[model samples]
Structure formats: structure tokens, C-alpha cells
Target: MATTSTQRFGIFAALALVMAATRVHLSLFHHDIWDASWGVFFLAGFWLRGTGRWAFPLLMAEAVLVDYVVITRMGISFWDHYCVSAGYWFLVAAYGALWIGGSWLAKHQRGIKLSTLGMAVAALLVSENACYVISNGSFYWLSAHVPAPKSFAAWFENLGDWYLPFLETTAVYVGLGGVLHVLAVQLARLSQHSGQTQH
Candidate 1:
């Protein structure tokens, strides 16, 4: 649960580069736009350090930057821009908790089972659906506007409309997240071994 400044900076810098590259190369970056997000980076930090506290600030930065870029540059309402961003924070939380990597997923002696992964994927899809339904309108939910769903009695009636995009985006992001987690661990292990050799 502790680390040196060097390790932290190395991980942060590596993740930032990966995120920027993924955003720019979505069409050919091993995934599509829907799956784009420094999701891999987020989860990597989470598992490597056993907490994604670093990712929170990054995600927040992403949200704020996106809101401004979209609002000021493209004439989008600033508030509306963040409404849809809400779901991404939820996603960060989800990935941050992925303490495993499949049959091989494990953290601090705790391995992740297939059951956990399934539940996580389902939970994420539902969370994103709710996010779109609330932020936009179960339709556009474009900006940050919390679409007042007249009554809780029928709040979920428009869920299906938001399912496709959410699933597509999260699946690819989460899959990449798994990769990031492994990469971070491997990098850390490699660093340790290299140090041992020098010693």
C-alpha cells in the first residue's frame, strides 16, 4: 500500500501517454470510439496500487476539460457536458474495484472469479444506462441536465434506448482496463527485478 515517488510518477506518465494515444487513434487503436477512455490507465492504477485514488483526479480533469472544450469550442452548454460525464466517474469506480484479472485476476491474495467479472460488467451497463437516462433524457442526455423523470414509478421505461452504446463502450474500456492492470503489475515487477540485478 506504499510506494516511492519514482514509481508513482512512472505509472502516471505512462498511463497519460496511453490515454492520449488511445483517444487520438480510436479507429485503429485496438478498439473503437465507444470504448475510448483512459479506462485501461484507470484500472491499472487501481490494481497496481490497490486503490484508484490517483485516477479520481484524472477523471475529474477529463470531465472538466471535456466540458470546457465542448462548451466553449463547440458551443455546448457547459453544465450539460458534465451530465453525461457522470457515468464515467461511475465507471472509474467500477474499474478501480477490479482487484483481479480473470482466472488469473488477483490482488493482495484475493483472486477475481468469473462470477465477479460478470456481475461487474452487468453493474456497469446498468449504471451507464441510468447515467444516460438521467443526464440527457434517456434520449440525448447530452449535457449535465438531470432529466427529471416525472415519477419514479416509470423511471426506467426508457432504458432499452440507452443500452447499446453503454455496453459497447464499457466492454472495450473494461477489457482494456484488464490489460492496463496486467501491464502495470508487470512493469512494477520488472522494475523490481532490474533493481535486484543491479544490486
Candidate 2:
């Protein structure tokens, strides 16, 4: 149990580090990397499911902090930033959808099999779409950044324009994460088998 707790903490720390490193790249001196914020949240949901009470809130706060720092660094007031609006709060829901999707996947996962892969892809598709909808919809409808006279057609068009890019970016990170997950699982199994053989 102690070892498990330590391992969980390590995973949490790693996720937090990834979030900081990727989410704040624009604010940092370099601007070469794409933001992995969405992937981090999904992976966190999968890896840190049991710790959501503290971990989820902590990650959310970290996201807000990153945004605040980035905006302030650009000479924009935190509250006055075009991204910061009532719609901004809806991000909590958007991210929650991702976290929940990850948690659901974790619950249903049954090891390294084609079925598991299918489930993972399904979960990612559902969660990512739901998240995109919440975040994009809120921003389009509620944020002042968009000019008035919002309409269903315009919103649908906007979704079509951005959805593919967001999905692709998230899929790239999540795919890497899936590879790492498979390696870890395989290594653990090999270690266990070796230990049994020695016994």
C-alpha cells in the first residue's frame, strides 16, 4: 500500500510537471511546443482517478494560474483578457468531461487487448467531442470576443473549422501516452514474471 501510494504520487507529480511545461510554453522564453493541456487532463483522469478530489482541483487551479501568468506577461489584465469571461468558468465542465471520460475508461480497461484499444479510442472520441462542445459553445455564445448576432449555423461552422485541429493535437499526445502506458504495463508484467521464475 505504501509503495502504491508513492507510485500514485509520482504519477501525479509527473502529470503536474507536464501540465506546467506544456501549458506555459507561450509564456516562457520559447514558443516551439504545442500545448498538451488537454492531454494532461485526460491522462490525469485516467492515472489519478482515485485522487480526483484533491488532484482535479489542483490541476484546475494550476491551469488558471498558467493562464493568468501568460496573460499578465502579455500586458493584459487577468480579468480583462478576452478569454476570461463567464464562459471561462465553463471550462471546468469541459475539463470535467475529459476527466470523467478517462475515469470511465480506466474502470473498463481489461489489459492490453484490441478490445481495450477500441474502448480507449471510443472514450477519447466521446470525451474530446464533449469537451470541445462545452468549451467552444460557451466561448461562442457567452464570450464577448465573438461579435454579436451569434447563430446556430455560424457556431456549427466555427466548430467545424477548429474541431479537427484540436482533435489531432490531442490525439497525438494521447497516442504517445498510450504507447508509454503499454510499455509500463509490459515491463511490470515482465518484472513480475521474472520474480516468479526466481521463486
Q: How does model 2 score by TM-score?
A: 0.94
Give the poorly placed runs of model 2, Cα more than 4 Å off: 1-3, 27-31
Q: What is the C-alpha lDDT of each candidate?
A: 0.49, 0.87
Give the number of the best model, judged by TM-score: 2
Question: TM-score per candidate, in order?
Answer: 0.51, 0.94
What tens-digit string does per-residue lDDT give for candidate 1 at 82-102?
444544345344433332221
List all candidate RMSDs to the true structure.
6.7, 1.9
lDDT of 2 by residue, 1-199 (tens): 1128788788888888888888888456565777787888888888877778988999999999999999898898998988788889998999998888888888898878999899989999999999999999999999888998999999999999999988988888889989989989889899999999999
Give Cα distance to truth, residue 66, candidate 2, Å. Answer: 0.7
Question: What are the clashing pairs of model 2?
Answer: none
Q: Which regions of candidate 1 fall more than 4 Å away from where they truly are?
A: 1-4, 14-32, 38-45, 48-55, 80-149, 183-199
